[model samples]
Target: MAATGFGALDGIRVIDFTQMLAGPFCTQLLADQGAEVIKIEPVEGEDSRGAGPFRPEDELRAFGGYFASVNRNKRSIGLNLKDPAARDIALKLADSADVVVENYRAGVMDRLGLSYETLRERNPRLVYAAIRGFGDPRTGNSPYSEWPAFDVVAQAMGGLMQINGPDRFTPLKVGPGVGDLFPATLCAFGISSALLRVARTGKGQFVDVSMVDAVLALCERTVHQNSFQGEIPHPEGNRHPLLSPFGLFRAKDGFVTLAAHFDAWWVKLAGLIDRPDLATDTRTATAAARVANNAFVYEQLELYTMQRTKKELAAVLGGKIPFGPVNNVAEILEDPHFAMREMILKVDHPGVDRQVAIAGIPLKMTETPGRIASRAPMLGEHTDEILREIGVGIEQAESLRAERIIG
Candidate 1:
């Protein structure tokens, strides 16, 4: 038998009805931590399967790098929720599953008769988690609740874009799907907590994650600035509002971040910049003074940094002063630390000829470390197997396939 990589959530089974980033990312975390994740896709597959940069040769299989990134270490079972027979199979799967995770809009699950109320009647100990652009039912519905949301939309409306960018004149959205991934990680944490409670008390709970809420939670520093001090935060480019010498500076080749958060480090920074006078200068001595003379202090730091290469700056201040170079994707991929941690992995797929490097699981454990057992499943690859386990026989499974209920 294959080692299941069963760690914390070994015996727990998750029926995942999530597609794309938020939901899949949640389930991938669970899968990585030893939960058995059975992803239920639409009969034709989730829209993500058709999304691209696709492999030229295998259009049907290697749909997109985006989908491939988050859906690893999971099993895919296709079901047409619109069909009665397929719905029955879904209910059966839910009955057997300890948790059900979905990112559907507010009322979609109820319309499909797969709502928690209905599913809990079958299995009362099922943890139901829902991820959304906004909050769940308890928060009340909004005009845009039903409207589909992309990461950019959430970032724009959820206050992330407001405080980002170099200045107020130019607002920038965060590069990756922070709007989605943040909420997904929060939802995963809540879901696991609910599962732990279920194990102890034989009771299930609802887990709701709002992308907007998650984004707001991440803006904690901004909140503290506004709420306590009545100071409205603006785009301050690379400098930390409170902590001086704690942002990016221009090095010879590129940019590097120097987080001299402690006073000792600030003293060291003054030495590094060859301004020993600034170390004890009353107008630039304390943290408050450094904040007051922010422009002057940053200018002094930049002058020294601009004379040295990023690598040279890093060599001097990397671990000592909490400094790091701004690494792009290519630099990150080539980094030795990333390789040592196995952040990059090689995997073979029937669809893709040569083994390509994919991201490996981030959570490491000594006893039962996670593994990338298989590639993301082709649409409906495990449909028959999952259905049969749920009490649909081979003949009935074939009939459902013919009827477009199973694909």
Candidate 2:
């Protein structure tokens, strides 16, 4: 593994009090960029550590794929926050840290005496980022701000479940946690912006991201269509709502997609498919005519496409028309494009002897490059080393271990 002490964020220290996907994913990005991200896990570890997809060969260690996927390039320090000593140590760690990220329900940090308001009093220039399921109440009297929520609930209430799928008859949530990931990305951005402001003003700020707000921002197009055009944007299946000839169609072996959106491309498509007559036909001549007769035009295209294999159709349609064959996971893994771009990276993990391949970083930068250096850590793997760095001595660290404050 390459030394994490030399990445782009080399000098930036992040005290992470977050767990599960969203918060961990955000910190992982920072870790990859060279931040010294110290993940302060509870003594038992994060909820994601137990949530599996575990390796059958190694069940004892914290090697769950879900946890590993979003938590590489970071060190873990176990701290039982319920313990007063551990809480004190956590504050000490946060005081010297450049940034602190948390995704607990709004008031959980306050309950733990680790809120931005409290911590910033001790570390004036610290950047604090928080993620939530929904916006905090503007005026509140209840102690319910500490309630927890998962990704699925965020999806259901965050407008994602309303806009996804074929139609109003059956609304489907997105395949991945779009709600969680969106807010996570935004939280990371907010943290970066806060860090910048702190650098200039010498004053830290609190950054909050709501999964519900993020999803609504993502669904702004739907909102605009309904309000401006009086068009409730129903899911048009695989087809795009505003573009013609922009959907999947049947091929002999499987499915092929088409996107001949421009009128000039439609002319070329007609020629390639040997349907020149339909190119100038009264019902299909102009763009509006073609869109009005889209059902008939699509049915005709499918008639020809269904007789040809995906490979055959794609070969013929290749740049003459914009098209692609439906590719599955196996196909994607074997694809030349993905391999050439280094979209997959092979890592030799401690638990697994053989190398395991996972998706690599998407961003490509010339100077400050990102690399997946280390596999996810075992629970409390760096507990002693990290505690010592936080000014705790070896003998005191041992006592903390004996007292179960550090595990």
Candidate 3:
């Protein structure tokens, strides 16, 4: 772990009043960029602490892979908001924060006396961000605002699933939790923008991100295609709806993909694959022409691609016309590109001897470069330290702990 923080958001204090994927993920982005994020968990721990890919040999079960991946570069404190004293301490923490983020249903914070309105009154320039299934009432009202939503619900409802999978009737959820993760990313961006605004105006505002709305916005292509051409887009599988030779093809060992859909690339690809005739054939001569005869185009490419292994095809086609073999996880780990980009990061795991890999920061700031500064905290790892930072004495912390108020 590094002693010096990433300088980008060095003094920006974030009170993470969130748990699970969406909220924690958004705050983690800020944390990675050097925000002082103090995560507020429960007395025992947050729910995701038990969401495991744990080592069978480790009896502690301190935290799981799911928790570790999204929670790096942050500090945690356990407090029971049901207790009035605990709620008071939380309010004290929020009073000093530049941002307060949560992903609870509309009224959860209010019920616990930790609403945005109450916090902003005490700290006028506090940026309060809420990520929800349907958004907070301060922004707009929705019938589904009260309904519970996870990644799957957002995917199915927000048009992402409709535009995926093998066919129209068999729409499928994307493998990753895009619904949650994308909204979390958006919320992070929103928080950054809000911070910039605070610098100018010295006024805080509510930043609301709806999971379904975020996914729908991500599925922008589907909306435009329907509007422009009256085409209700279907599941595209591994092919594009408007281009030929722009999708996956069979290889002897595994799958290979290419985007040789442009006329220049198509002609070049055909020549490279020893089918110069495809460049002259009227059916596949032009990009639009080949799209009209897509089946024939795929058939022709598959004829060549299927006979070769993915490595063989890559050797022939890589960088010549936008082509590569489909890489699995192990292949990704072995590839130098990932290491060069610093995309795969290894962080220490509690109760495990060896470090585990998680995805790293994607942004590349030349001056204030971000890095995973620390592993996810064990439950309330900084409870005493944070309490002292917030002006609570050691005796008070011990008393709170005895009363099951703080952990």
Candidate 4:
């Protein structure tokens, strides 16, 4: 059979009313799959465009890496939804789209008269998705629904930070913006599910994802540990609570992680280290015993590993065992795996002379592969063409421009 052209979502159109990470990331996933994602932003642009990491040489600093990274493969339209005329234009766009996704607080869309109920009246088959700090009241009422939250806040409240530090007394938020991103990932899945149902039944549904709930779901082990064990799971440093060698290890140049947790692998690892006695020692024999003496186990492992470089360790353990070096961004750029898998991409930046590196699509489908359709658009890049497509005359467009409705 022939492979799918462009992407699996070639025919789908998305009206993206997302500004920052959570919402934009979700829409970006769809855009990667060849959905015609029309990103609706404020007159200036989306909020992240103002955020930085822009090259010092960039004169047209309208957008930066933070915005460009997640916003690739989408068109941008600048509209002031506070204005009734602009709201009407947004409604038209939403009605025309197969999906509409936003990350505004609970009532923001309702205030703008672009609520799901309002749009579903015109397009019953439109999938409406929302990402919120707590959640929409329609699904479940949270006491902190009105409170503003970001990635760290969700990580803290969702039990992830509680079990992520060197000790229980010191909690650490993850290095990444997992709170925003995890919810974005889940919301993307939800939107896809809703779209599938819409195709099958010719009916649309509202897909809601709570940011805090998503974080809690991600740290699901924390819940069962407390319930089943009658004990709270504490910060585990870098090692597993039950497994012996399932976490990071010290190395000469950098760190590496090894996972010789099972008995077979453990014995092999002991033999590799020329410490056969470790396999027979009652203190470090089985998985349970190793866990009981984890501190002693790590100290002994470090005595051997601390003398070798990350590359040297990889040479010994690369495919023979579940081992990986803790690489930074530079190492990742130099690694062959990312390039071979197409996980790192170089896309043209609007003003930058050189091509900028952004992440490539992860969902590899044999029949319908995802692809980057285009680089991220400039602010209001397609306003004229989009207005023309929506049947607005030149004079009418000029009037909207005059009124600061569409940028």
Candidate 5:
């Protein structure tokens, strides 16, 4: 791996008290931007480390793909917060950090005596962020505040599942954990914005993000449509609600998406598909006409598309129209576009015998582009180094380790 030189957030320090996906993912984004993030895990390690796709050859199973992918570019320190000594260590770390992030149930940190209100008293410049299923009472008390939620729960309640899948009657949870990820992404942005305010005012603030709220924000268009038109939106499968020929269609071998929605594009599409007469036909001449006669237009287009292979269709319609073949994971790994853009990266895993390939950073900056500096840390990999930095001597560190206070 290449050195990630002084990045945009080089001077920032983050004390990460997050686990699972949402909070860890938020801190991961900060770490990617060059923040010094110290991930504090329990003595047994973060839960995701046990959630696998583990290497069959590895016996210790220190971490898995789910943990590794979201935890790259950060240091790990295992501390049993159940111990008062460990809690002191965490407070000390937070006192020196510019930001502190957590995603536990609302009162977990309070019970641990490490809540943002307590921590900010020692370090007022600290930006504290929380990611929750509904939201914190500090921001707004949610009816489901105390209820435990997972990705599926957030998707089902937040209106995303209602507008997804093949039809209104059958709603499917999205393949990825967008419910957790979207909230985490928003929390990252909230943290960054809070940091800017701290820079100007020298005062820290609480940043809260709700997973349900985040998902609803992502489905904003649906909310407006329902309010304005009094129309309850439902899944339309592979077709757009208002546009014609703007969705996925079947090719001879696989599937392709062709979006020719404008009047001019509709004419071009008709001519390209050897249906020049359809370009001037009253039923399919204009955008509104094509939408009104959508079934007929789609049937005609499918007849032409099903006769051609994906490559054959692309050859004629690639640049002429908005077209792309549906690519699976295997195809994406072999794609030149992903290679040229560095979207796929291979990283070395310390315990695992083989290298692991994961998705790369998407943000591109001309001067301070983020880089994956290192693979995720081994469990408690920096315990000694961190203890030394915080003024613990070797003998005392050994004593703490022996007592299982620090791992």
Candidate 6:
């Protein structure tokens, strides 16, 4: 748990009705910024609690890394929403919330009588946000609106996979769950924007983000290239389409990325590699000329870089050009820059003997910086506390628990 301190979103409260990566990630951001987030889970618990990379010593194995990483700094309340009593509790929570976020498939919330339209009538100032696979018809209808989607499906359908691999024929899904995460990020932004409007006009609006649409937005360049140049973009290995020397190159020990896209940086890079002649040569003098002779340019650059270690190349090019050593997880854990910025944090996890390091908040504020306040909750860890806070008597809470309505 983090020490007591005020955060940017100190007074705002969020009712999180989300599970898995996309929805949890968005609400986690809000919680990190000090929103009082109440995560309402099913009686059986959120599915991500079973995801692994678990601590071997933990006998119970209540939750795993996947759940822990995104769920820090929030309280959990497990309620069986299928039960009418539990659904009523959820509605009451929403009635007092500043923001309500969910990522269920279309119509699931409506069927439970907890849809945005239903909640808005009781709390008109609610900022309701949804992150769905194909989005809701309230904004725009999609043919795949009712279809289920995961990260891979979104990547494949949204044109990201088509441009992500070594060649056009071999498509690759990105290693990270960006398809879910990007939409979550956009939805978080939308919620913040809507909250600002609510403060100004006292009216809240629906904010919808689709996984496919978010991935497409990330690859917007492809759409314009196809429309304007009549060219379907293909995977160009590690190289950029229009920029020369703007991608990865093999080194003696590992790989390094060099991005000398502009002429001045290109000239400096050529000089640093002891090939000043290439800086003035007609074949590679300007950005356009370099792109025209990309094969020869990359070949010559690789010839010089392949003989040097990543460390040796970094010594010469680190600060001068946009150059970086391609680092894996182990390397990143030891990198000084990441340490300096507090991007790697050691967080305490229950039932785990040692502290676990997770990625830290990226947003830094002078007066009200975000922080990791607490570990992910145990299953229904705060159920009774939350119910009591919301005016449910202890006897009623126990009765609900006995009936398996609240975990």
> Residue-pair clashes per candidate, as listed?
0, 0, 0, 0, 0, 0
- Compared with the true structure, model 5 gives a TM-score of 0.96
Better of 2 and 4 by lDDT: 4
Report how far residue 399 has shifted in candidate 6, in Å.
Answer: 0.8
TM-score against truth, every candidate? 0.95, 0.92, 0.97, 0.98, 0.96, 0.98
Which sections of candidate 3 miss by over 4 Å?
Answer: 1-4
Q: Which tens-of-lDDT digit does each residue in 7-118 have in candidate 2?
A: 5677889999988889988998888788888889988888888787766776465567788888888888899998889999999999899999998887788889898888
Give the clash total for candidate 3.
0
lDDT score of model 6? 0.90
Which is the winner by TM-score between candidate 1 and candidate 4?
Answer: 4
Predictions: Cα RMSD each? 1.8, 2.6, 1.3, 2.3, 1.7, 1.3
Task: Give the per-residue lDDT of model 1 (tens digit) for 1-407.
Answer: 11255677777789999998999999988887777889999888898876766666763564567777788778888888998888888898899999999999888999999998999989999999999887777556666776678688778777788788897667788998999998999999999899889979999988888788788888778788888999877777778878887898998999998887578988887787678987888867888888888888888788789999988988777777788999987998999999999999886665777776778878899887877776677788777777767677898878878988888
The local distance difference test score of each candidate is 0.83, 0.81, 0.92, 0.89, 0.89, 0.90
- Order the candidate numbers by TM-score, best to worst: 6, 4, 3, 5, 1, 2
> Which pairs of residues have clashing backbones in candidate 2?
none
Off by over 4 Å in 4: 1-5
Tens digits of per-residue lDDT for model 5 on 42-81? Answer: 9889889989888888787888899988999898899999
Q: Lowest-scoring 10 consecutive residues by lDDT in candidate 3? A: 1-10
lDDT of 3 at 124: 96
Evaluate model 3: give its TM-score.
0.97
TM-score of 4: 0.98
Worst 10 residues of 6 by lDDT: 1-10
